[model samples]
Target: MTSELPPLPDTPPPAPTEPPAVSAHVPPAPAARRLSPLAAGLIGLATGAAIVGGTWAITANSGPDAPATFTLKGSFALTDSVVPDGNGGCGGTRGYDDILEGAGVTVYGASGDVIATGGLGNSTYDGDTYDCTFKVAVPDVPKGERFYKVEVSHRGTVQLSGKEAENGDFGASLG
Candidate 1:
């Protein structure tokens, strides 16, 4: 038996059309990669350090007395350099040593006035000295307030880890 089929519709079948239009132009840059925990921590630490350092430089100048005190602690490293002409107390005409005995940091108020001061004792590791840490009790930063500054000082010798960094005015936060 022959099967009868319906005639074709008036409209022709759809054509094999090309894919939808897509621009060849480069897309926006991909989002930044995520950081590992360790990397993220290190970055955070570095950023915090930079901010504090900047604040320290900006706040080294004299300012109105701060009613609140700030206890600031931070780490510092010195680059090798020639010893100053002074011949005593970590300073000698000869090349200086990287390790230092007199290393300290002073906190300043927003107005660039001295607030609190603390010393960084020498940190020795396998007969090598380093500036590792410091703790100071500054009685000038008014509590509850944040923005501030500081003056970091480290008296070290040449041929050693120390730099004649200028007294800077660093802008910072009270954290």
Candidate 2:
């Protein structure tokens, strides 16, 4: 046998849909403020000037608190053959050849420590003398009286010593 079912109840109808509306009291979005062409150009010019000035100062002074350098100036001659100065060098009464070139010169401090070294430069060829001057920058040398020795050597076998090697700002002669 079949059973009977209950009937459904009545219901209300639904409303139609639409896009949401914005409020009238809300303000509109504002636009971004911009500088004029002249103002922008001036600002860029100032920035460039500042950067250039800073770089120039850093380069010109070699940085603040850089060590003070002292220069040791000298000259010498070279011989074609080796001579004896009793110290495996040509620092005595030995005669040199036409000119001395490519000689390694080293300057030492008061404590017998090497201060600076370089090759001879500014060669001037006179009548019977071949001369060259060397300049070396010695750093961290304390102020006051100090002794300096300049040795001009070649091939580690023959060399020459300055005349006033351990004294004032004197010019040393090659032996």
Candidate 3:
């Protein structure tokens, strides 16, 4: 008894599906555009400059008007019969040793608050006038007060109008 094989169908089996072909030469991801070292440095510098400029502008315009200030200038004249040593000070003349030199000068606000302090400069003696004159300058004294009080050494405080303080033509006299 011979076994018979089944008859093959006429329609051919469906063709095998294939995966799409991949390109081997994919263009390297566009070389990331790189900045030159000089360009990078310039950009960094510009950014830093912009930040600094912005900060400066904010600070320069934000604060109260620099507390309007003026140099309180004045002079002290001491009338004495003692002859000067021709130097800036008395220098042992008549038992006086530069009494005006380095003397404390104080500025007081309207509220009696101490505003500024300075020392008297050297004294110059005038032969004809018999006056030992010295100059004192209290720099950067705040303005806008109705009045100011100025005192030299232990001398009493002298009240001055705003205009007088601004003009800076006030002083103390001692004999």
47-103 in candidate 2: lDDT tens per residue?
999999999988997766744554444344432333333322332123444224445
TM-score, per-candidate, Cα-based: 0.30, 0.36, 0.59
Clashes of each: 23, 0, 0
Per-candidate local distance difference test: 0.43, 0.49, 0.80
Q: Per-residue lDDT tens digits of candidate 1, residues 72-175?
A: 43334332332322332222122334334454455544455554565544432221332122223333344432344444453421111111111122222111
Model 2 / residue 141 / CA error / Å: 6.9
Which pairs of residues collide in candidate 3? none
Q: In model 2, what lDDT does residue 107 have? A: 64
Which pairs of residues clash in candidate 2, taking residues 3 or more apart in a chain or in different chains? none
Best by TM-score: 3
lDDT of 1: 0.43
Clashes of 2: 0
RMSD after Cα superposition, model 1: 24.9
